[model samples]
Target chain A: MSENKRTEVDQLGEFGLIERITKDVEINHKSTVKGIGDDAAVIDCGDDYMVVSTDMLLEGIHFDLSFMPLQHLGYKAIAVNVSDIAAMNALPEQVTVSIAITNRFSVEAIDMIYQGIKAACKNYNVDLVGGDTTSSRSGLVISVSVTGRVAKDKIVYRSGAKKGDILCLSGDIGGAYMGLQVLLREKKVYESNPEMQPKLDDYEYIVGRQLRPEARTDVIHDLREIGIVPTSMIDVSDGVASEIMHICKASGVGAAIYEQKLPVDQRTFDACHEFKIPSVTPGLNGGEDYELLFTIDQEDFKKVEKNPNIYFIGYIDEAESGARMVTVGDQIVPISAQGFKHF
Target chain B: MSENKRTEVDQLGEFGLIERITKDVEINHKSTVKGIGDDAAVIDCGDDYMVVSTDMLLEGIHFDLSFMPLQHLGYKAIAVNVSDIAAMNALPEQVTVSIAITNRFSVEAIDMIYQGIKAACKNYNVDLVGGDTTSSRSGLVISVSVTGRVAKDKIVYRSGAKKGDILCLSGDIGGAYMGLQVLLREKKVYESNPEMQPKLDDYEYIVGRQLRPEARTDVIHDLREIGIVPTSMIDVSDGVASEIMHICKASGVGAAIYEQKLPVDQRTFDACHEFKIPSVTPGLNGGEDYELLFTIDQEDFKKVEKNPNIYFIGYIDEAESGARMVTVGDQIVPISAQGFKHF
Candidate 1:
């Protein structure tokens, strides 16, 4: 119990800690085609590969129950896990949810959470196959594990991108970040004056974006329909810039994204202005968007060129070039990912 | 939020709550062969069936860190999930462990937990595939999801026992329950007087059972080697009486177990005597044993009859007979399952 060295967890960071824990892990199963360091692990299941991913959400760390409805929290739990599956170009088939709750929650509260879970299951066409529910000593803890399948040749990875591949983003970013700002502001106002009705009518879009973000399964479907699998794929759960760096590092390539091309919703921009936060900052650093960030070969761009939801932001480059962002004013700056400091 | 109804979760109980939440769930995937009702969810994996199970353990609710070592806690987490897989007569191939911790834990403490996890993974021959590590507001929470495979025909379910099947017990039971009692007593002593050393030397057997229960994979191996698949099977996680009821309900049959036939280690019996708790009570209701309970066709009993580690406890009966226990004094008593009430 008495060790001279005591290093804080924050010192290692999330990814670094993961690397340290998994460093010595050796895959003993032949069916395990891939393990760790990916959106989902791949297991060879004869005709196709089974993809597995798990996520744990703690109350105060992952969400604030004050503004986040139990139903939306439940839906987001499933959606976020499914986003991992979608990131691997897999179709989610089953999910297992495990929750630990304290007595402060009523049976009705649990039902509301399940309602949201069921809604997400229906929306994603995934089955709620199994789960565990237990009592917690404190706040709620929700952990979800999703299983998905992809054709052997169709699976995508963050390490698959090549130089000159066009970077594509599905839908706008920063909405969820702006939504969180609005929710926090409203919460503060409500705390200051309990009788005052919080103004939320105009911030509905951004707030909804934060509370009920959906997995970009539509983009996965669109790619499948067009028969063009992305060279590299990742879900933007940790913001665009961080995910871009992940793809670049894993693919041993470089990325150049245009700030002017970064998609931002009108409502999100307005909220960002009101909050006195730079709109682009949220787009680059705001998380929980659940959008798909991917790279496709330049030749295949024509197939999705007219798609309104897909935005071409930039292109891949040689590894020596490193990751950079071209500002709206035409100045290029090195892009550094400031991921969420949950620890 | 107020509908004039407030039913506490304790009223529904853990199993009842699970049934209530899963009552209206509809499975949408063809790959999902069995959902929500077995030791693990069964999925179609082409030539074989894949069984998946997940469990979550919170700090205070599941284990007290004051007496439970971090390493043993990590090992127990994986072992318990693997026990669910073993209950389905499957060999676990991979597991995903998601953990949430507060800043109170040092990096070294986290490593100790992972060290135990890695040890269990090595012992069980399962790979650590994927997991999520995040921050918690308070205590540590570990959620493990395991995937195992079994030949389609060899997969065992709790619903397969027929009348006259001989009930079999693997290794021993009630030891873990006694172990917990000893640990709690020692913890109380240590708390009151920090200078006092825990008198756990004589309680080693029971204490070890509580701290480091192993999944009965050896029993599964023996059964496979002997070419004898049980008619029905489940892990003795929630004590023998509760598991007996599960089998009877699922298989539409009743059971009759002999109290004298129940296996209790000498140390466990001694601890039970000292604590003044009936030895039979722990055998019937003491949980966390992690032993395999199964029913084999009467004809197959001869194969395991001479196996020293296996014990013949009882036999399956007609549904109309009802579940009962033949006491040591020859008096018959109806059995009731008082499972762990974590809720």
Candidate 2:
């Protein structure tokens, strides 16, 4: 009721706000094996552990509907949540989607969205178990919650990394971010001149990376096939730098990544050049990649060393060293998280 | 992209729309015991069954901040989701809450919401394990997903009722609906005259019903103590009439509720009279009661016949009879579901 002191949400940031909210929460249920802070919460089932995670996407902040097809939007919603489950080394079994839209959207529009949702459901082999659909006063809001399962011995967390573990990435980074830039530029051009046809053919790969991202469950399957379990794992949602910092803080270890080892597709690199931005900047700080950033034991590195899809980027180190990156010119600099600022 | 045939969502209604969306879904997991068309999705958890449900609430549609305090709003959101778990005769173990808010909210305001959420977590014995926090372009949106567990034999669904079963009510109904009316009236008064303070003391009982309704977990415990497993069950979220119709349709039976047997709080009855609305209207169609409506075999009725909180309001009949209500004047009227129209 008092207006004397009002602190903006941006001041605390997303993580800061989450920490404040979870600080006082007490776990009363014995079945809750893990709570808060992890990619997903782990619950004790009879034969295995259940992993649950949820994410909320808002219009304007998370996506621009102007250039985004409803079908891709629906598919991306499921993929993002599934990526969280994949981060825990778990197989997602079910997902619940809740969407709020205004009357401006027609029933046909909703069907297109579901067409994409059903496609993702089949692709990931996860059932559309339950959801809630309601009306919103303004823009669209999509919230998805997914549940997954993993063997008790195979469950992984962000706190499992060791000092000598090898850090690896599932796929290339920054393509999604570069794709967004291209789309925004094209949108501006189309808005300024109605007759201008958007030139997007050359940027197809990057645009597809942004419009439709995959969860990397295949990579999880590959690791299982090779008899390797990630020591620590996290989804590369908020870029490699921010995710690395999270792994470091949770595992109580530092990391040193090499700039040259970072994976950036050729198309993404060219787009970066055209946009007048450094490729490494987008690779390190661009969010929404939905790739997996994980660390495996050094002894198991030989098993996946030759894998084409997996790239070795860094190694875990003592906590005192902090998280840093070595430049191409032999300069060492501390990594700062400049991820997406929703506020 | 053709605008020739745009169908309004309100035409299909919420249930119709859900049916349209879920009609083509294919269940791909053996662990999924039940999907959609239930209070929650039931999944096989080896020794037991896990039930999952999700609900979304938006500002201006679900609640108005003018009369609905943020603390109570947070508490109600969790309670409503937990009620769905209770509907399936399960014990909730964990919940994930995802919220999106605009910059208009302050740190203190967020803390208040979390305080209420934590309080509900303690009361329900459920853990706040995971959640997502992000910025919204407009009003606040809260989406809560809850997972609960029940013994495989005790898991109840809406499709298990049989002819000659007795219909039972967990507690008083129509209070929450009347409560909303009182709040809306008081809100309008305050809006017209800014200096007018809301006179809510006399209507505290009903107003609290709207703002802080509790899930009927107590009733579930009572049923368990008496060795009773409801043949069919549902939460009284969308009024008694809508829920009964759901049970009849799912179970392939008919039900006849007695108007005189409907339970109403004295305060709610008095308020309804003052508002010049029939008491039966809110009792039969008023929603958000969060009470459990269930059916039991007539042979098992004696076990809970004397329970104080349980009221016997109706009986199951042959499907050909159709769902109806017997008025106090000895007239029978068919029931229609004019439930909450969020669209």
Candidate 3:
């Protein structure tokens, strides 16, 4: 606005631009318990707290329609927002989905997308509440906002971890990232030779991970059942390394995760080998995993110690140490974030 | 999905498509008081009801940056969503804005948008909560989700009006639409003659109406203060005729509105005359006016009778009468809906 000064968005990156934009915001309501820092915004609604989270998924930038099924895209849009609510250890109750689409889509095609949305809502036990449907000039864009509830005492934030806390991850990582790789590869092959069918039979597991990643609402429920609220929580959206950095930065503590303890599915490793990617690179930096990466206090660690689904791979340390990974070769290397780079 | 059968979206139109999509939607949560078909979804949160609404605005469809300042675009985006909250007679508490921008946008350009967002939040007494920032493949896209609270007894729906109820309209109409016409004319003129500056001085009022329309939150507040709640209410987003049809269809009644009673600003009339638009046509079907249309009981009419801001436009009648408009020449004509046709 000031004459001819132009600073490209990528120069600041997504996180930096967000910080710069929201710096001068002022909260005006007493019900707003939390604003723009956590996975979801927290609002105090008297008896319980309501947590709200939103996500916007655009075609091309977030998905390639050639390989990403419309149904899966719709389901993933809902799941992505639900995952944010799960990160706060909350129960999602309602969601609003707004979609903008080009006229290239037919009613049946849109219905297929809604079928997936309905399936996801039923799976997550959340009601589809309200939304806006409009015309778009380009590719499809789906934005979902979810509202959930948590008891006053059971809320978890990303800034609650302390020194000596245990870092935990749910299930395995890199499958979704590798799944995208497989899809992209198959797409390129199909483009060159239309006669060649996609060789997705052997890559079903990884492909499924990419097409329909589920939110960790089940883990949130399991944690509540175990009566152990995580000290800090975040979803592994941008892989393990970036998630570790977020936990470290938010809690003002450092973490040391062991590469040897990192969980990997056989199918994921196979896809990684096929793609010729480094052993730990996809596991550390590959994104869209949607797995929960949380920290639990040492005293409560015994509760989840025997849980097979939760993988304990690290410990929180002093802030000065920073975030680092202990490799299988017994080397300590600082973890770097290769977070969302859509800009 | 059914073999070769393809139903084009435009065949159903926007409203028909919405009805088709939400027809079989199942509400899975008791907390979901009301879902689609209203201004905002109502969720029961303890003693009061929490209302949520979402809107997606694309560059070419909802706005054009050439004439629409980024700051006003940001302001209008939030205002549009907030208007839905006001339509439900709720006080907005917080809002989350998700934006997708291309690299063509500078940090300063984005900051201008946020500055307007922050300004609107301050003006509307709402807090800036959470949002997503991502790179758009094409033009800018802004999706905003707003959450507001209304007392259980104070929550009004479009289906509450009864026969004999007085239809009330807030302020005026058609200014925003006329303002848009003026701007578009100016844009065309500028396109042909680049050196000619836009002649927007005389049309400032109508131009502002188009660029930055305000939601009728004041009327909601005044109604609350007066201890009078309308039986039903809706906002004029897709023309007053469409809103009348919606209220009639939902309430299962009819109405006879008077064209002589329709309120119009002086500048709006001037612009309408300049554009050669027929009298009363713009008032009936001009969209994006963001004014409240409600029906009040005759017993409570005296409460708002002295209020100059409130205009008595019509009265509810028997269901068989349908919705008709009484012309200034004393002719009766059916009010037809020219609603959102984005598809």
All models, DockQ values? 0.87, 0.82, 0.89
Output candidate 2 Cα RMSD: 1.3
Write candidate 1's Cα lDDT for A1-343 as tens digits: 5675899998998888988999999999999999998899999897999999999999998899998999999999999999999999999999999999999888888988999999999999999999999989889999999999999999999999999999999989989888888888889999999998889999999899889999988888989999999999999988998999999999999999999999999999998899899999999999989999999999998899999999999999999999999999999999898874431
Docking class of 1: high
Candidate-wise lDDT, in order: 0.93, 0.93, 0.91
Model 2: per-residue Cα lDDT over A244-311, one tens digit each: 99999999999999999999999999999999999999899998899999999999999999999999
Global lDDT of model 3: 0.91
Residue B299, model 1: Cα distance from true site in angstroms: 1.8
lDDT of 2 by residue, B145-194 (tens): 99999999999999999999999999999999999998888888999998
Predicted candidate 3 versus true structure: per-residue lDDT over A1-343, tens digit per residue: 4667888887888888988988888987899999999999999987899999999999989988998888898899999999999999998999999999999999989998999999999999999999999999999999999999999899999999999999999989989888888888899999999999999999999889888999999999899899999999999888889988988998999999999888888889988887889758778988888999999999998898899999999999999999999999999999999874431
TM-score of chain B of each: 0.98, 0.98, 0.98
Error of 3 at A250 (Å): 1.2
Q: In model 1, what is the error at residue A297, expressed in angstroms?
A: 1.0
True contacts kept of each: 0.87, 0.86, 0.92
The interface root-mean-square deviations, each candidate in sequence, come to 0.8, 1.1, 0.8
Residue-level lDDT tens digits of model 3 in B33-57: 9999899999998999999999999
